[model samples]
Target: MATKEFDELALDGTNYPIRASNIKINFASRGILNTIEEPNDGDPEIEPRKLNTALFLLRLYIHKDLKHEYMLETSPLNLWKALKERYDQQKELIWPEANYEWVHLRLQDFKTMAEYNHAVHNICSKLKFCEQEPTEAKKIEKTLSTMLPEDRILTQQYRTNNFQKHSLLIHTLTQAERHHELSLKNAQQRPPGSAPLPEVHFNVQNNAKNKKGFKGNSSNNPKNLTGKRKRNNNRRKFKDRKKGKGKDKAPQPRSNGNKHCNMCGSDTHVAKDCRIPKHLVLLYQKSLKDKKSSENPRFEAHFNLTHEERLEVASSHQAPVELESNINVLPEDVAPLSAMDDMFIEYCSTDPLGDLQ
Candidate 1:
């Protein structure tokens, strides 16, 4: 860490083979490598300071327990030799395990090319420290041989590239794996008819429940009466406008003592609750006409009939035309008024569906 060189490794005996190799690199950077390899006495002036710096680093990083044994050694060359002799046997001790790892290394065993690359490099590094480093071609062959059965064609292609270095082979594998993954993802994206939408589990916010309680949906809402009852309800609403609100509430007072008479002229007192029809209210009718009310207007209609037209109108209706009960029908040989007959004829003509039938 102190110098911009190969990092110092702890002098742990178990990993002494790699550790010693790293130490050599560390010493070489300090210009004190000759002190270790040539075993010469460093110059009393320049070499002593460089040797001392190297020796101090070596002493500082060694196993703390082993410090006492090498503390008395003054010369760096003797000290360096002493460390090698003590830990050099580590290479022989580690040789079999490193050989086995290199021999058994396989690309297929690793889930990713990165992991396979790391494994190959790790084993190669250890083998190199043990002085049995694998050749570039041998490492390349190892990868090809260990590939999955499905990747035989891919392995052959890599072999055909004549990769001169192990690193080039590793880069090729990584790039190939990337393209292969892209192909798989592309294949998965192909639509059969249309790509299925991701399943969503959600509720419509309008009718959804809150934290307080569950909400009422359309099905849970109050139901109105159906069929004939529904028709009766609509009729009742229209009728309510013509009449009063309900039988429960009282109507406007007609008492002479209370207010002026605006409808029918009557001397006898009428209960306040009694309803007065709008048709009897001349004042209201006058005001409504003055306002020219478009929403509600009464028009007197006309009626006329030809014999052929009468026959055709009669044929259009599915139900038997109830002549006597109809508003156009008159008793005692009296002719129906023009306005009444026209209303009945117009009602039939307006019903387009009934005309087709």
Candidate 2:
């Protein structure tokens, strides 16, 4: 047991000297503690020897400065007592103010439960060493009071539950912390809005009707429909000019007396001798027809010409019949009028034509 006590004191190093009173008490309980005075003849020197051995071990472990000052003493027990009193006086004088402040003021400043628990444990150990340890309830109360505002509800709940054990309170707070972390993670993962996007449905029937109306209008619209007819007429006129099949074969000079071509509005020739392409002339005629077809009574009366006159105008723009030709027109190139009508309908259906209007 003495050997074990010496080993334990060795582990404490020089900084924490073993108490002289504790050593004496342990030795007395073992019936080995005694004074170091010389004994009578035939008395066993065992107690004195043990005291010398303890003193030697103590001197070996103590700091060099302490040994130089206290090692000269003849009585090992008195030496031990003196060292203890000196060190205890030093401790009482130099106990740090910061440590006391932390016990009272800074305990609550720990950010995490682990940190707070570790600090509280250390404080409790120090207080226990001084024989002044606080109760577990006080420790729990201090911990709950110092917690962050976010844990206020949990703190209140724990208080309401009136938890009897400090371990239970700590376990509950840690679990609450984990739950709070999980809830924050879930909130971050979710999208901001609760409302979903609206569904859109196209009215196929109404679209089909609108498409048909647009097709009909595009097919019957004189402006766009007569373009091919005018081009055909222009081709015929060009052929006639090349063949010199008109009334005036020679190049005509520009007429100086305001004799503009009625078909093309040029001050060069009469309407009959105008050099305008036959297609253009036909377009002009279609424009005139459209004007006559309008709601004007004067234009309607002007269009009331004899059948022979109408026949003469039609014959003037007619294409010369081709006897034979090498160029074969592909069926794909010459799309049927009905197909063209459908193309215009599809275009009008897809595009909003209000801007054009």
Candidate 3:
């Protein structure tokens, strides 16, 4: 290998090390030189000074920190999409100017730490939007007083590229504040004695049979005038007597065995309890049954209907019939059909077999 030193060069101020190794520069066969040179060995890592210089240049390029300001003004939803795209394209490596500006702008300038953190995260949440930030995240922790815990973690995740932004911090805060205010207002507006414990009112009617006494209620003591079993029996006897059944022949309650239909909530009936006429019920039963049996069911309930209600439903359902009786025969002396009518009739009459000949 032959090395061309800077001292040998005519007069260029900067020193340039020219490589002229046994490995020939293939300028002829393939058009461009794509192979790596031994000196600048194409290692993945760059020198610290060079890296620092690149960072400085990147910082300078994003001078105004427009990315940060934009985040503060724009919605978190918009900032996230831009950040993810910039990060994925290796903008941080290839075009640091664009990358830093994109992230910084979206992250910084948030009015609240929560807003700032949330904005940062929304940008990083590409793979999984539901991703969360580490508990020990720094930025949110620094501004703990102003920033919500979730927002702090979210910001750290986005800034460090660990988690995707799942929820908007601003919205969550707003909703929480609203709920709190509503609760406070409700608490204040409530009546002082609102919802007081329920009380039962007792009604007493003096039968005037004797002096003021516990006429209806029973006493536990056998010596008391009214006893529990006796009181109950007396009430039953009074009810039977009021019903006008024979005094000795005890009155019995009705045993119709009719029960309300659970399906339609109709009184003491199944679908058969529907107010639809018996003939219509029979006609439509198959359709109703088939529909009910299917996944999507449409069962109609018709409770016992008043005469007016029955008439209304029947009238609504009945198709309008064009009655010949309602048709008024125009008097010949009144208004006669114009000449156009005769022409129309003649035209229509021409097709006799087309009509009811």
Candidate 4:
């Protein structure tokens, strides 16, 4: 099976520490770290199985060329020791880089405080791996020294307040940066200036100017021109100008007074040009005919016709009720109304109103 969790460890003298660490972690996980850490002191017969397992893991992660050469080794412990001896020398080669990076680590070189903090931690880790870990004081001093020139005063302020704690210094820097970004954003959104007046204010001022001094026509009483009249006026004015009637002059009226149409009574057009609705003209002609033939009119309107129709409709669906006489008829056995009057006069003459006897 494939145990290649990482890139194959090249035979070249590069990137051996990280690869070896990964290999160790992989062996520890498989319960076979002991094969490399200690010898197989339990059983002689089981020794060959463990040796093959360890060799398989190592070969799975090593270069193809190194695989064939390392197969000749019979012991896992000696092979582990030999691999370390050949690859572990790169640490010395990495020391100069750690020192150079440490000297050049500048907070100003990174855009954010978080990025600078990350760089500091990363460089410190690299140094610690190479046995050159930085102290707390050295890290703070490095940060203070590498700040941008504009922030030199800010560094002094932090130090004056005894912000020797690296965490406190970082917190202060981050807060100050946040406040600075907010201020810049606010400044860009709206600058320091008086606000301009609204649209209605300008319109009112222009209207006031025109009302106070404009003399040819009052602003209140503008010439009411219909759309068609305005178009005709413009067409006639253009023709007149082409004929050299006048230049830069107001258009002349078509007549001494506006042409009044008798059909519709609109002053913009004469009777010939009037466009009265046909329904309205027809009704008018009907009114004249009705007046001329009032006694024998063509359209004879019956008054209260809807009431008569309603009574007819109500009786149409109902059966007729027969009656020989109405309730006003008196029966033969009843006395006449003259006898009723005599009885009433006799009852009245008896003096029922005399003292309550």
What's the number of clashes in each of the models?
Answer: 3, 2, 5, 0
Off by over 4 Å in 2: 1-49, 94-99, 102-108, 165-167, 175-357
What is the C-alpha local distance difference test score of candidate 1?
0.71
Q: What's the true lDDT of residue 268 in model 4?
A: 71
Q: List the residue pairs that clash in candidate 2.
A: 230-279, 234-279
For candidate 4, the lDDT comes to: 0.73
lDDT of 1 by residue, 1-357 (tens): 565343344556776665676777777776777766664466544467887887787776677767887789887778878888887877887789989998888888999999988888888877887889989889988989999999788778887889998888888778978998998897788665677675454544533555338456544544533455778988998898778655656566454655434344443434353366757666665776777855554443432222333465543323424466667555766655764655645245544446534
Per-residue C-alpha lDDT of model 2 across residues 80-162, encoded as one tens digit per residue:
66666666543443345324843574434866667767777766654554456678888778777776688688678878998
Which window of 10 residues has the lowest lDDT sum in candidate 1? Answer: 300-309
Winner of 1 and 4 under TM-score: 1
Positional deviation of residue 122's Cα in model 1 after best superposition, in angstroms: 1.0
Alpha-carbon lDDT, every model: 0.71, 0.62, 0.41, 0.73
- Displacement of residue 350 (Cα, Å) in model 2 is 66
The whole-model C-alpha lDDT of candidate 2 against the native structure comes to: 0.62
Q: Per-prediction TM-score, please?
A: 0.49, 0.38, 0.18, 0.47
Global fold similarity of model 2 (TM-score): 0.38
Lowest-scoring 10 consecutive residues by lDDT in candidate 3?
Answer: 13-22
What tens-digit string does per-residue lDDT give for candidate 3 at 106-174?
333465436655554544332122232233343333333344455677456534643223244345545
Q: Write the per-residue lDDT of candidate 4 for residues 124-145, one digit (tens) a residue.
A: 7667768898887787788888
